[model samples]
Target chain A: MSAANPGATSPQTVHVPLGDRSYDISIGNGNLAEVGRWVTSLRKVTHVVLISDGNVAKYYQQPVEDAIAAEGIRVTSLGVPAGEQSKSVPTAQSLWEAALADRVDRKSTVVALGGGVVGDLAGFVAATMTRGLDFFQIPTSLLAQVDSSVGGKVGINLPSAKNIVGAFWQPKGVLIDTAVLKTLPRREYLSGLAEVIKYGVILDADFFAYLEANVQPMLNRDPAVLQKIIARSCELKAQVVAEDETETTGLRAILNYGHTFCHALETVSGYGEYLHGEAVSVGMLCASRLGEKLGVFDAESTQRQAKLLSALELPVATPKLSETAILSAMQRDKKVEHGKLRFIVPHAIGKVVLTPDVPSEMALAAWREGIEDESA
Target chain B: MSAANPGATSPQTVHVPLGDRSYDISIGNGNLAEVGRWVTSLRKVTHVVLISDGNVAKYYQQPVEDAIAAEGIRVTSLGVPAGEQSKSVPTAQSLWEAALADRVDRKSTVVALGGGVVGDLAGFVAATMTRGLDFFQIPTSLLAQVDSSVGGKVGINLPSAKNIVGAFWQPKGVLIDTAVLKTLPRREYLSGLAEVIKYGVILDADFFAYLEANVQPMLNRDPAVLQKIIARSCELKAQVVAEDETETTGLRAILNYGHTFCHALETVSGYGEYLHGEAVSVGMLCASRLGEKLGVFDAESTQRQAKLLSALELPVATPKLSETAILSAMQRDKKVEHGKLRFIVPHAIGKVVLTPDVPSEMALAAWREGIEDESA
Candidate 1:
C-alpha cells in the first residue's frame, strides 16, 4: 500500500493533450494495487477485458483482476503467450472472441497490463471491438511505459509485416507502476533503457545528461531513478504524440530516431534475433554514424552514446548481417518515401532531425562501420 | 464522357460537415466514368486499391481501374465473392494481403466499388491497413448510396456477430452514380428502397411524402427521382452523423429506427435470409406496431409504412420463427443496454424515439401481429 522505497519520488502525472482523446500517464512506484481506483477515476466501467501475456499474467494478473473487481467492475482476464509472436491476428481474434464470450458490451473497457506486445495487441483489440472500447493501459515494462503506452498507435502484425494492421487508438488513461520493472528479466529491463536513452538524445539534452549521471542506478533499477526516467520519457513522448497523434504531420517521425536501421536489423536478422531496444542501441549508433557521414553530427557524440549503451550492457555493435538485405529492408521501411532512404539522424546528443534522400551507399557505410571486428 | 441521362438533374453534392473529416457525397446520373477526375479532385494519389465483390467487379472494376489509371494513378483491383459471406475475416485478410502484395503504401487510397458489403469490408480494410488509409467510396447500390456509404461505419463480421469488429473511418469522398442501379438485380434493387423509405419516415415528413408520391418513379429507377431521394437521404444521415460521428451521442440512435428488430429478424431467420434492407422493411413495421401498442403512435402510421414498403416491393410480413429465438436475439442486440430491450419506436412519420425498458412480451406481440394468417 505504501511506496516500496521510502525515499522514492512522488508519483507524477504526464498529461497528453489530444483534445477529447487526451489522457494522463500516472507514473508511480508500488502502485499496481491502485489500478482499480485509477481506472474508475478516469472512466465509469461496468466490465473490463484485462489482456496480458503469459509472462506478465503469471505475476500480475490476479492482483489486477482482484483490484478492478474490488471496484465492483466485472473483469474478463485474457492471456496470450508472451513475446512478439503474440502480437498476431490469431491472438487478437482469440482475445476478441473470448471477450465477447464473456459478454463484453459497449460499456466495457479494455485494460492492457503488460509490455509493448501486450499493450499493442490489447490496445488493438480495444480499438476494434464494438468499433472501440474505452481503453486503459497498465504498462508493466519500461519500454511500454516510456514509449508504446504514451502514443495511441495500437496494432497487430501480419506474416509479411509487423504492425501492418492497426489504428491510432488512444487510451482513456495510462497507469505505470515502475516497481513492476523490478521483476523484468535483466536483458529485457536493460533493453527498455535504450528507449529511455532515446528520449534524451532526441529531444532533451538535460535528460540525456541525467541518464548519463545515473547509469549505475538505472542498472540497479533504483526505484527513485526508475520513476524519474519513466516519467520524463512519458512526458517527452506525450508531448510529441499530442502534436502528431496519427503520424500524419511528420512531426512525430523524429521519435523514430534510430528506428530506420533498427527496423532493417530486426527484419533482415529476423525478428526476435535481438530485442527491440538492443537493436535500437546498435541502430542509434548507425544513425549517428550516418549523421557524421552526412557532416551534420560529430564522431565524439556517437562515441558518447556508444559508451553509455555499452556501460548499460546493450548491444552496441551491429550484428554482421548482409548489407544488401539491410539496404533493401531500409528501402521498404515505412519511413522511406518514393524509394528514397530516409532516417532520423542525430545532430547532437540531444537533437535529431528527419533527414531525407540519403544515398544507399552512405547508409550502408553506416551499417558496415558498426560491424564488430571479431578477428581483430 | 457525358451522363447517360442527358436531362438527368445536374450532379449534386451533399457535404457531410464533420470538421476536418467532412467529405462530399457526389450524386450524379452517370458519373462512374468520371471517377478518375472525381478522385483526383479530392486527394492526390499515386496508387489506389480498388475493392469490390465478384458480382460488382464484373460490372465496374475494369472501368473504375481504367478511369483511375487514366488519371495517371496505379490501381490494384481486388475482389471477393459477392454477398454477406464476403464480409468476413477471411475476405478481409485476403484483401489486406493482396493490397500489400500489390504494394499499398500509406499514400494509397482504398476505393470501395460495390454494394454495402464491399463498402463496409473495404472501409474496414482501409481503416486497419497501415493504421488507416484515405478512403473513397463508389457505392453501386441504392442501399450503399443512401445508408452504409454515408455513416462511415465500416467493419467485417465475425462468425459470432455481424460487424463485431470495425471502425468509424470516414471516407475522403463518396461517389454515387445512380445509373449503376440499372444493372442491379431486381430483388436487391427493391430491397435497397426499403432503407430509402425508412430515411424518409425517420427524418423528414416532406421526404416521406416525396417518397410516397414518387414510389412509381422509384420502382422505375428514374434518374432524376433517384438523384433527389439519394441526396436528401445522404443529407439527413450526414446531418445526424456530423452530430454524432462515433455514435457516442444518443442523437445517432434515432438512425437505428428499425435496426433492433431488424437484427433479431435477420438472426433468427439466419443471415442471407433477408437482404439488410428487406429485414429493415419488416423490422420497421414491427417497431411501428410496437409504438402503437405503447400508445405513442397510431395504426394509420403503421399502415402507411407497410403500404410504402410493399409498394417498393420489399417484404413486409414477419416470418414464422421460434419466438424464443427472436426474443433472445433482440435481447442480445447492440441496441439493448444491459438486459433491457430498447426500440426506436415511431410516434409519427419522421419522428421516432429511442424508447427503453420496452416489455419483451409486448415486443413479441408486435412481431406476432405482423404474421400473415393462412386461414384468413
Candidate 2:
C-alpha cells in the first residue's frame, strides 16, 4: 500500500486518473492559492462561470475568482440558494439563464464553487447544456471536498425520488483547499467525516487504521492530519470512479456501500432534515447488521463502527422508519435491478462487496435488529 | 457508395452503424407489430412507461399499450402537451414523478411514442433517472423517425436557450411505423421532409437527387417513399453520432449544418411557435447565404435550395429577427467555441463541412443579407 506522505515537502495530491475525464485533487492549507495555473488552461478559457450558492459565495467566491482571473481569464459568478432543495430543475434553468446572461460561451468553463448541492446541480447543467461542457469544482465543505467534488457524479433530485434526475458527467478538475474548512460549522464538518471513514473501510485497511488512530486530530481540522485524510479519501474515490464511470459494472456499486440505506433515510426524513453524510452514518450501522446476519461480519466489527461513529458524534442507527418503508424505498433505489433488493455491504473492516439477492426474510430481521439497537 | 435499392422486393435496410451506440432503423412497413417482442424482453420487463403527447396519445396510446401488454409486459401510458412547451423542466418533472408512481424500476423501460418533443423529453428523463435506464423510440411523426429518434440526442429546451439541457442517451431500439403518418397534419408532415432533404444535402448526393425526383410522392407520404427517406436520413445521423458521440472532434459538427440558424430562430420565435424542422427549412436558406459569402458555395446552389424549400411548401427566407439580434442569438449558439462563430456550411449539393472559425464580419454580413431578404 503506497501511503501518501503528507510529511513530504511537496503537497499531497490525489490523482483522479480518468483518462480524458481525469483530474487531480490537491490537499493542504495553501492549495487554494495554487488555483491560477493548476486549472486545465489559461488560453482556451474565455470566461469562468463561477456557480456557487449564496452561503459559500459570500466567503470563498472572491478569492477563487481572483486566483483564476489572475491569469487574465474572465470570471462571471452565479449564486443560487444554499440547500438540498436548490438541486432542482428550476435551479438548473436559472443557472442556464445566468450562464447565457454572463455570455458563457462554449469556451467558457463553469466552476462549481460550493458544497455537494452546488457541485451536483452545476455539474449537471454543465453536462447537458450544449450537450456536455467542462466544469471545475472548488468544493467548500468537508462533504463536498472529500466526496461530491472528486467523483464527477453530478445530478439533481426529482420530486418523487432523490437524485432521480441527472447525468454521469465529470469535472475537468477539482480544487480542494483544506484551509476553507475553517468556515464550516462543527456539525457540517463532522458529517463529512462519515464518507472519509467509508473509504478506509471499503478499499484500504491501513488507511482505515490511520483514520481510527487520528480521528480526534481530523475533527480538530489539524492541517497535517486533514491533508492526509482528504487526499487518501479522494484517491480511493477516484480509483473506484476510474474502474467504472458509468456504474454499469458492480465495481462501482461498492462505492455505494452505505448509500442504499442512506438514500431511504434521506427520502423518508425529508432530504434537508439530514445531511447526506449523517444519513450514511446511520445507514452504515444498518448495513453492519445485515453483514452480521449474512455471517460476513462479526460483533466486534459492528462495535468498532458504532464506536467510531459515536466518537465522531455522527448518527449510528436508523431513525423513525418502519422496516416496510425502508424496504419499499430500497426497491426504488437506482441500484435495484430486476426486482431484487441489492445492497453494498462490508464483509469485514476494509473489505466491501455487493449482495444482489439477500433473502428478504434475513433483510427484514437485519433492519428490525438495526433500528432497535440503542446505538442505532 | 452503398445504393439503397428503393424498388427491391424487401426494403433495403440502411444501418446507421454507431459502433457501440448503433441500432438498426427498420424502414420496412409493419415494423411496429414486431416491436414488443424484439426490442423489449417480455419476460424481464415488469412494466412499460409509454410517454407521448396528448395529441398523439389520443390516437395511438391504447393500441400501442395493448400490443406491448399482449406480449406479457405491463404498460402505463403518460401524455403531455404536444408542442415544444412540453419540452420544459416542469413537463419532464411531471413525467418523472409519474414514472415513479407507476413503479418504474431498473428493469422497466420507457417507450417514447410521439414526435420530437415527446421523444426528446422522455429520452432525457430516461437518461437521468437511475443514472440512465433503457428507452425505446416509436416515432409517430416523420421528423422524429428520420432524425431525432435514431441518434441518441435526447434533451429539453430552456426558456433562454433551445435544447440547451439534455444528454446523449441512446434508445434501446427505435420502431418506425410508417402507418402512423396518415393522420399527421399536412404542414407537419411536409415539415419533416426538410430533415430528410437535409440528410441528402449533407451526406448523400444520390439521396438528394432522389428527393428532387420523388418530391410529389414523398409529400403524399407514400409508404415506399417515406420508408426510403427515413432510412437514409437515419443512416446519415447514425454515422455522424457513432464517430463523434462527444462532438469534441469536427465529425459530429457536420450534423449541425443548418442547426446554428435553426436554434436561433427557435429561440427568437419562441420554441413552441415553430416546429424544429420548420425552423431548419428556413435556417438552411440562411446557411446557404453564409456559405456563399464565405465563397464555399455559389449562387446557383443557394437558388437550388430556395427552389426545393418552396416546392416542399417550407419557408425559405429567414424570420423577423433583425441582423443584430440574429447575430447575438448566433453568438449564444452552443457551437461557438470561444468568441469565434463556427458554422457547418454546405460546400455544394450533398457535401457539408464544419468550419470552426467563420469570420465574424462575414457571418454578420450574411445575417444582414438574410434579414434584408426576409423583409423584402
Question: What is candidate 2's CAPRI-style docking category based on DockQ?
Answer: medium
lDDT of 1: 0.90
Tens digits of lDDT, candidate 1, B1-376: 2133255578989999999899999988889999999999999988999998888888889998999999999988888888888888878888888999998878889999999989999999999999999999999988889998788999988878878899999999999999999999999899888888888878898899888888778888888889988899999999899999999988999988888889999888987889888999999999999999999999999999999898888888999889999999998888888689999999889888999999999999999999999356
Error of 1 at A167 (Å): 0.4
For model 1, the stretches where C-alpha displacement exceeds 4 angstroms are: A1-8, B1-8, B374-376
Worst ten in a row by lDDT for model 1 chain A: A1-10
TM-score between candidate 1 chain A and the true chain A: 0.97
User: How do the predictions measure up, each by TM-score?
Assistant: 0.97, 0.88
lDDT of 2 by residue, A1-376 (tens): 1233446324766778777667666666777777777774523665788898888988888888899889888888888998988988788888888787776655668888899889999888888876677788889899888888666678887765667677788777777887889989999999999998889878888888887787678777877787778888888888888888877666988888788888888877776799888988888877878898888888888888888888888988666667687788777777777778888888889898898897767766666666645553
What's the count of clashing pairs in each model shown?
A: 0, 1
At residue B75, what lDDT does model 2 achieve? 87
What's the DockQ for every one of the candidates?
0.83, 0.65
Q: In model 2 chain A, where is the ten-residue run with the lowest total lDDT?
A: A1-10
* Chain B TM-score list for all models: 0.96, 0.91
